[model samples]
Target chain A: MNDQRPRILLADDEKAITSNLAPFLERGGFSVTVAADGQAALDGIAALHPDLVILDVLMPRLDGREVLRRLRRAGNWIPVILLTQVGEAAERALALEEGADDYLNKPFDPSELVARIRSVLRRVTPGQPPLASAWQLACPPEAPGQPALALDRRSRRVSLDGRTLDLTPKAVALLEYMLTHPGELLSRERLLDAVWGWDYPAGTRTVDTRMAELRRALGDDPARPRFIETLPGEGYRFVARVVAA
Target chain B: MKITWRDLLLAALPAALAGVAATVLRLSLGRLAVLLLRADIGTALVLLGSSLSLFLLVYLGARRAGIARSRAAIERHDRESGEARRRFIHRLDHELKNPLTALRAALANLQLALSESDRAQRVGDVRLQAERIGRLVADLRKLSELEERPIEQLPVDLPGLLEEVVEAARSNPAYAGRELRLVVSQVPWKLPPAVGDRDLLALAFYNLVENALKFTKAHDPVEVRASEDGRALIVEVADRGPGIPAEDQPRIFEELYRGANARGFEGSGLGLSLVRMIVARHAGSVSVRSRPGQGTVFTVRLPFDARDRAPVPAAG
Candidate 1:
């Protein structure tokens, strides 16, 4: 309570996230206090007056939004960052509009969290400032070398390993459909209806041609394929890992 | 809608006219009988025949009018719901697009990230969004598959399946990964085995319980109960979290339907729809009853064969 380190109140009901994150934040040069739920978080904020608060959006009894509402309603200009679990845009916008200085998604890198906290603190207090959990829990953020394949839907471009590959409209459509619906056994009918219009004058073979062209562009081998797999007599499956950009 | 006295009088005027006409006819018939047959019995017979025919005509006409009114109501309801269905299509795209847009930005940031940690951080961002997209795609598939194919039928122990569903939900990594305990109401019973794909039924129950967990605190009782109701098996999952608003209750089971409160929470919006579809596939029904602040309860009724009435599999 008397030390120089900025105090941070990290409130989340999830023990796994809080357990690993609290230690990481403390090690990163902040005195971390934890609250199990939103109501407890409100109590902690009033009693402790921590430098900053990192709130989780979903909690028992009172949710993160409700806590933020009460805090802002009471004219407390405390800096807050929301750890939103859903990767939704309207929700992110709503979170910020509700007076959060900044927001981060869950299953995030701890270093990123540290960076966000630093930026939000500097902006809030001019020089010195506040607080936040996260990272090292929830199974270590999938595997490395992720997102090898990325698709830009706006430009209708498909990129592999950071390079945009030249693919026809049909190939793009087919790949886009496959990328979006991963691990699905897509029949020729499903592919045709999705990529091409239902009334398009083409048969299932049209789907096969698009598949081959897309495969050729992706440089995926038909045998032991890394990206897409052909399930004989059934349908085609997008077997590769796709991180949608 | 506010029925004035005038409207009521107007409604009664037709019946009143009919009564007056009958009375007049009966009197006239009586005079005719006195003039011709010279008997009061003749007057009574004519009145009885005429009144019986009038009553039959009124009954037939009223039934036809009632049916026409109901049919119009049903058609209006269908049109309104069709409009609602179209309204929901716009919601699904945002779910996938948001994650993908974030992923793209992160990948773009990776190029500019100077330090090794920053690059790692950006990649981590990309990975998380990709996984989020992965979950949405998988959920969509899960929903579509239920409609596109037939379900397998097999004898599934009711109590055992429910216990396993609660168990799996308790350990679900989505509940902040670990050490999160769900308080499920006691689920011990003797009942006939339900005949359906065991895995799907398990998924249905697990989704229900997980939804309950999402809205409620860790210590809140996610009440689970199972009982036999004549020819069906009834299972209920209830929660004491903020109950769904009345307006959102009807659309909650639709695909990609995120309620006002649900949007702030983490969910794909397909969980309940999947449960509904799974129940439908087995000729069962899933329904929700909730009051704001009081909580929500989902009841699933699966019809079982009458022959398997033996109370077996008392295992928990």
Candidate 2:
């Protein structure tokens, strides 16, 4: 039998970060190409024609944003995931607007990146409906007088009642997943597996942190939530109406 | 000795009154005077003596009023400076006590027989605490020097200096996952040079960026943007986080004033104060605009050419 694995180009100036992250990506079953700077990253992406790119926001020469800008200007639609430092929400949004597929803040658990990579790949692959279309199908249409949460996949933004909510990518992802499967009981393990991926450390509070942040952004009280409801020993449920616009 | 018309009038009024009284006495006791001494010499002598006494009284009264006014002024000055000194000492104690307490606790934790990971983490905490203490001391020293020492101003590249500050912030491990962006709105090639101490200006920019990052989340980007504002260059560090409360905004630049929302954050509360001090030392001014739950923008306006401006006077 024949095996074809997805290719990923990892561009970062820090050797310590790339060296560690490259091996992790390879172990997760992707052909990884390393670029030490922005120029090299652009060269590597063109030369390798990788399926996806993980670019660091702060890089020498061209920088991650510039690289992404150039790639999009060249009309390359390959999915790109930005590796950003913390406190860069605006940069993340800008990158997404510049055609980046996703972004993960630095000091991130490598497993989360892997999950994002697979998820983005699945959306871009030939056979499957894109993630956005799938999300739309799962979401209800906007109705008057009812509180609605809408996630714009293209911009990577979440809005409630026409107001853009300030939510971290993780929180946004969690809310998106819950919105897609409204009223379904999602256990902690299942949510973790779906959101953080399988390699994430067990007993880590990744889900809880994301959930708490999501709840806070929604203004949903834990005890009496209008959107997310905690089921005691079970995971959580999105009780509010989710609309796709 | 150079008496004015008013002084002359004051001096003459007493003598004139004494003269009038003496004349009256002379007229009334003319018979008695004629009978006793056969002259008005006694009345003239009494009048002269009374004039001297009244003049002396007026002079003494004026001197006493002047002394009282000077004493009140001195007391006010003393009270104001004393209050300021007390506030400064209180802030210093609070800032120092924080790091000292954290360092002590970290050290005590290190002494425990813990696992390798726990030990390493404890050691990291101790190092961080120590660094915090070092930073506090360094900031205090810099602030004092800024107040006392005259800075060595030189032609410094404003954009390059901002880039350096952003680079330093990027390399900070504590903000490893934090995003810092330097947006130079001016023409890169034609950017004007600012006259300042490179190190001090860089420190001011760094402190502003650091302060923004401290209040914001890892996902929020702390934007450091610089543009030319007429003859002055304006650098703004903006953050989209929980903004400063209206009441806190006024005192945010005050030394050791932590905002109401700053609880649980690891800060010495000297960052903004130091930023203001550094900027002022460069003959610049720093101001902040923030709305609660919206965000904050700290703007530092520096003259493009501060070479001709006088050095900021030392704070008393």
Candidate 3:
């Protein structure tokens, strides 16, 4: 079961699909392991240590996204390609930005998938580019009051003036939303809905907790805030001139 | 059916009260005419005049209530059907796109084929996927036509139809080693013949049984049972397979809408929806009941044509 070909864990619920894709990938010189569901995909990744894994978003038991999120949260940097059903550009970019190597829309040619897999495996090889499947997101400080910050969406690495800063996924999501909607008067309730979702167990406390961590990670003093400005009765606001990254 | 009961209550209760009120008003007016003014001949005329007016009042009130109830039902039906149409269009893309993708992959393989046999195999793969897309388009057309085509109002033997569909299901390759049971029982009477186009009815029943076979495991028994409740012949195809999720169950019969749990199985997502349109054309309704991890049973009730009340001769 082990060989020189790039090992791929192909996770899709469709039997017809796995039968077709498995042979195509094998012919292209990659060892393929077909996982019928999301749980099997995770277990396959652990046991096989495949070079790359292709995940379908809609599967039984666990979806591809939960699998991707869990893997990233556990700090596993294995290159992953997501097979997304959505054709929207922004959603595809978001999937790529979700710490995945790349995204291919469903019903795509197998060769296109093979090309993506080969490219991803090459990037993860030693002596290649530093961030594998990474997208560099920099906020341009075009105006005098604009903030100078850069955040890597794929890697979740925040940088202030060329200095890299570490942040959790939650804090990154909070900062990402605020950065995109600069100067908007965002209430705590609004932030919670946008970032943590209404179904999230924690109350407004999670918002304050993540904000505190964001400020700490960025080394910003709440008393004299540089980016996140908190009002006494109101909510937090990004006090910087910004443009869409 | 529940709505029908509610509507009946809405109309009947109000009409009954109006009838009592009309009686009281007639007696009061007759007494007032005779006692208050001492006019007997005029009292008879007054009573005669108020009867028609009171009848009109009650008739108009009941009619209005019926109209209101019908309006609400139509609004709800339109809303839900519109939603189903929207989902059908949404899923239409994925259903076509996946097969086309595979077809393209096969074509790509054909170009890379090294030997004659390899080339032939690739060509076969291409044909298979292309045929799949063709079948999907054909099924869609058949369903749309079924919607427009006038159904033949001929007597359809309910028990005979079930046996035909069940036998056909037994012969299917997928039904190998699987048990499909068909039971027809009409308490105190033989099964009544349903009224519809006979071929279409058969297709609908066959699709239901096929769906059961598709979802259940190879060894699971798929049962088709037909019974009559005086007004309709109720046929159910029950399978001991993975039950549909509560959310997906409602939309499963919508054209091209596949359940999340059923994505692993290859399908055009047209079978159940086609069954829906067919049964609907025959003046019948279909419903599903399922519990996740336990099993699912699809029930189709075809109302026996009211005019055709005679039960079919019992079959051995």
Candidate 4:
């Protein structure tokens, strides 16, 4: 069994908050790094290259927004979740638009943050296959006169109707998971954990975006989905009969 | 009594008009002069009486109108001020009661048989409540002093005072994540000394900065800028946060008048009122410009002491 754990960078200027939260996160199976201020947070991100970053919107020196802005500008797409105060809906919206993975208001239950972390990790981290045999069984040979979707696990590629789809690795991983599951009603959390990894803190909006991108690539409509069927608030379903090619 | 020429003219004008009317009637009826004169005289007398009555009526009406207008203005002012005083009292009671209740509850809880950690936490709560009460009382006292007491004017170093206030705010744990920056120009220009009590002015600046921090995000920078505008020193505290709503701006300086957006935030609402009071005492003015989404800028302008005319050089 692998002993590796996902690394989380927790940035807040409040010492009391970090001191209290870091241990809880560590107990939840994450290796946590604490940054005292915005500048420290940015420096930590550069040095640590952590799997996920939890940022407080208000921090001394650079602040969370500036840090996020710099990170995005530098093309660092590490999963980020913002910790904001209550009644900051406008700021929360701005954060999301600026590519923040998710946001949680302060005075939140620690358990809720842990749950979000798990869900986000699942969506962001590409889960490792257990065995080579399991990889081979991921997709089987295609049947005659059927529209088929094939996933080449080795190449991290997905092909539909013998035509290669230009998909990001994350998108391909998502497609592979949905195809493998077939008729199962996969919840967003399940998809997030299964495809992204166990500890990613990306929100359902992230899942929604990836789903939209995948649908566009597969030439599927959300209103009348051919392959990916959205269950609105519940989750998504792959209705297409995917055969092994 | 000494009558002026104007008063004599006013008295004679009616009689003159009556005489002129009588002459016209007598001339028109030349053959029947005596009978026409008698009738014309009677007509003139009636006309004079009516004209005098009308003049008196207009003069009295004009005086009454003037009195009524002033009376209405006085009554309106009294009503408004009375309502304002009532609101101030009501808010004071409410604000004071909150901490008092908390303190009582904490005291009661302290009598319970609890663990060491729980007892310590309860003690902390009690201390916090006590501190809140102290702050409320202190603010009320300061507000009254600012309103009633005469400010002891001195040549105050505007930049130094602001730096001290900002530094104090930066060190406060409550404002831990917020950035407090003093925005200065590349040219190190000297700022004229504002004529005010140093301690009171510092308190005003501190309150403004603290208020800014309360509204702004922890990461947002609260910039304090000071410049000389001729004879006045203009100090502005700007924040990048959700601004005061249009409707809230006018009444924000009123005692205990909180804004619509101030619901979730913790404040006594006495800060700005105190600032306004202090500035007014120093013969200065404070105003705010804010838009809903953009941000807020609170500008305080105080006159420089004419006695200290020499521009003091900026300390390196």
TM-score of chain A of each: 0.49, 0.57, 0.52, 0.51
Q: How many residue pairs clash in model 3? A: 1
- Give the TM-score of each candidate: 0.44, 0.40, 0.44, 0.45
Runs off by more than 4 Å, candidate 3: A1-245, B1-84, B310-316
Candidate 1: fraction of native contacts reproduced:
0.00
lDDT of 3 by residue, A118-165 (tens): 766754643222242346545666568545788766556788877877
Q: Which model scores highest in TM-score?
A: 4
Candidate 1 residues B1-316, lDDT tens each? 2345754554565566566666766776666666566556766677666766776666555555556655665776788788766766787777877888999899999999999999999999998887777667657765765685645566777787776666666555656442333342344546778887665677788778778888876656667888774557888888878899989998899888888779867777788888899899999999999988888899999988655764445555
Residue B267 accuracy (lDDT) in model 2: 66
Candidate maximizing lDDT = 3
lDDT of 3 at A96: 50
Those runs of model 1 whose alpha carbons end farther than 4 Å from true positions after fitting are A1-245, B1-74, B173-189, B291-294, B310-316
TM-score (C-alpha, index-matched) for candidate 1 = 0.44
Please give, for residues B1-316, the per-residue lDDT of candidate 4 as tens digits. 2345754555565556556555655454453455456677776565556555655665565556556655666776798899999999988888888888988898888889389988998899998877677556656655664565445566777887787778778767888767788974324557768886665677788888888888888777789999865657889999988999999899899998878988656666788898898888888999999988888999998887887654545665
- lDDT (Cα, tens digit) per residue for candidate 1, span A1-245: 57999889999999998999999999998999999999999999999998889999889999998998898878776888888532222332354346666556554568767766765665464221221111000111135754366666545666766677987655665775566445557778556544442211124554765687787887778996877899998789877643423
For candidate 3, the per-residue lDDT at A149 reads: 89
Off by over 4 Å in 2: A1-245, B1-77, B102-128, B171-181, B185-191, B306-316
What fraction of the true interface contacts does model 3 reproduce? 0.00
Candidate 3 achieves a global lDDT of 0.74
What is the full ranking by lDDT, best candidate first?
A: 3, 4, 2, 1
